[model samples]
Target: MVIRDFDEFCRDITDIYESTLPNGEGQVASYIPQLARVNPDQFAVSLCTVDGQRLSLGDSKVDFSVQSTCKPINYSLALQLHGEHIVHRHVGREPSGRGFNELTLNHDGRPHNPMINAGAIMCCSLLKREGEVNVADRFDLVMDTWRRLGGGTRVKFNNSVYLSERTTADRNFALGYFMREKQAFPTSTDLLETLEFYFQCCSIEVHAEQMAAVAATLANGGICPISGERVFETKTVQHCLSLMYSCGMYDYSGEFAFTIGLPAKSGVAGALMIVVPNVMGICTWSPRLDKLGNSVRGIEFCRRLVATFNFHYDTL
Candidate 1:
């Protein structure tokens, strides 16, 4: 089961992708009307090695909303700019043990971690927001980061998805206001602008291969393999990946860690970005989701991936 070379790795991944094609056992996310419309049968798997070698199969070039998978990247940016100490003051590193969007906070009034809705919102507030840095500037910075993380590929925002999420995000509003009431955000935080920024990050779109590049960057110690650009600092990537390992899969994080044993982040848009440490980064997309909001086929691919190769951190 060892992947000695690129061809073998491609062959094995193709086999696994095909094997899960017929087993569409979950539903596309319906709460977000835009996501519910994605073709449930569309599936893709893409991988990028530390050396920048790449492979993709089935709809890998098709674009989908990056969704919550952007959390780790956003968190990384926060840590890079604010440092771990300042960032952790607003958001803890522990798992919430509840739904990703559940209105909850730790005993210290901080959001549990940056992977969930509350924490991500807090991370959004931590981003530089002041005079001369308008919403457009904020958008450019985040999208630019996503582009570099995607190995210089263009990553777009789905306006339809953003509008839909913004319109229907009462839960997010509640979470934001709750944290604001608890005085969790910075003194000058603008709640509306922060939530808008958060929605924009969640709505950024990337193809499967593009997301694999982002994951590969993390796996390669924050260096984008395709471009050889240092996108994030080593410690920043470490902190983001650690939280992703513990809390990135919503309520399913614990089980996913136990079984797949990789640092990963999942999006409701049916995407999973997985980091294999010094080995590679993998991305899988299938619109069918389990109750906990993870892509079912994406999880299956991770399980098979670890089984076929020594990709799991614990195993290594």
Candidate 2:
């Protein structure tokens, strides 16, 4: 059963956020014309425990595109479909030791890991359905996962954002072709269409409330608290979290793991999700990002969480 302490936890988080949500900060991601238009000052945070407790603050009802934060879910699905050996054939486990959008891969032509731009694209191909692997079907599964995770009855595409991704996706297009040349993505799928689907996956919208639940699934060892279902294998969650621990925050992974001390993921769309092992999931969303494209306020809140709670999965 959901406990009362979690409600107290929420109140503490809300109070902390209200006092310090970054009055002065950096800019939001504007590369994708649509995201550039979002209100930069908007911020939110949410938390959930394995026992089904929940807490939310600051624009809790607002939905935001998940962006690269979508990598872990799709990566888990890819691991389920293709298995580890085959999936590793296309992507590497080592952190790229470079920026996420470096437009390059490891010497072996594999994406350094499955969390960056190069690797996430590889996962999109890896997780695509067998017969046609179209966006509609792939997106339906993402929606299913969201419904199961978020407890929301409905989820839909942000068409304007999706189109903006398509229009400004030249860099990703180039990455796709480079991978294809390396035999990394040796398929007949059109690069634009595949990238379109990738963009749509990033565009899949959810509020901090649902994101807290999604993180709770990971914290609960893959069990959906609200849905009473298992969306991934236990081993898969471990692998996904391990990868997140090592590389999920894009360029900020090491610092994030050190400061926040949680297995976490961040979106260029200014969303953050952190998993606290058997305890709970914490999520923060704010459009303003530091140079690394991680949410500015999101990082500060996590810093406070780690410091105040003495939380750290590694320490556990």
Candidate 3:
């Protein structure tokens, strides 16, 4: 099953995608009104090799909210801006056994890691903590980074998703205030602004191919293969990959690490972004989700992908 060339790789991807299409085993996320309305049958699979070879299958051009897939990028940005030591001071690099929106923290008064809601909120607060940049400027920075990560493609914010998230973000707000009570946030950090920015990031929209490019950027050690531009420090990507590997797929992180063996992040929007470091990036979208809030087709695809290719880090 070695994919010796781009054509073979593309063929295999399409084959795998088609084979997995009939399982239709999960439900669309109904908590968010916008997400709940998406077609549950819509699916896409995209891959971008380290050398910039790209392939897509199914509804690859359809756009959807990035959801929690934005966590790793936002975490990387905060680490790049403030360094690991300072960032770790606010969020621990550990997995939360609970769900993504749990109002919990580690013993040290920090969110377990940047992949969960609490940690992500802390990461958002840390983004412009120096107060040198306004919230608008900070958001622009995030969007600019996302665009470059997507290989210079345009990625937009879905206002409907943003509004939906804002309306149903009671848990996130509770997490924020909980962290604030624990003094996990920075001294000058504004809770409301940080939470708003976090929701905005989660609302960013991109197709499967674009998200694959973003994952490929991280796979390429923060250098975009297509653009030949450095998007983040190598150390930043390293830190993010580490956290994503350990905590990215909500509470299913441990099992995914054992089976898929890749650094990846999953969003409630049924998006999965995987990084096969030094090899390629893979993105899969299916609006239907398993009970654990992961894309059912996406999880199956990763299993099939590693079984078909030498993608598992251990195998490589």
Best by lDDT: 3
Query: Which residue ranges in model 3 land beyond 4 Å of their true spot?
Result: 1-3
| Clashing residue pairs in candidate 3 (N, C-alpha, C atoms within 3 angstroms) | none
Tell me the tens digit of each residue's lDDT in model 1 across 1-316. 1235778668888888888888879999998778888889999999888888889899999999998998998899888878989988999999899899998899998899999999999999988844445778777889999999988878888999999999999999999999999999988888999999999999999999999999999998999989999999998988888999999899999999998899999999999999998888899999999988899999888888888877777778
Model 3 C-alpha lDDT per residue in residues 1-316, reported as the tens digit of each score = 1236778777888889988999889899998789889999999999887788888888999999999999999999999889999999999998989888887889998999999999999999988857575889999999999999999999999998899899999999999988999999989888898899999999999999999999999999999988989999998999899999999999899999999899999999899999999988889999899999999999999999999988888888
Worst 10 residues of 1 by lDDT: 1-10
RMSD of 2: 1.8
Ranking by lDDT: 3, 1, 2
TM-score of each: 0.97, 0.94, 0.98
> With candidate 1 superimposed using the best TM-score fit, by how many Å does residue 157's alpha carbon deviate from the native?
1.1
Candidate 1 TM-score, true structure as reference: 0.97
Looking at model 1, the pairs that clash are: none
Better of 1 and 3 by TM-score: 3
lDDT of 1 at 102: 92
The lDDT for every candidate, in the order shown, is 0.90, 0.83, 0.91
How many clashes (backbone N, Cα, C below 3 Å) per candidate?
0, 0, 0
Which one wins by lDDT: 2 or 3? 3
Top candidate, metric TM-score: 3
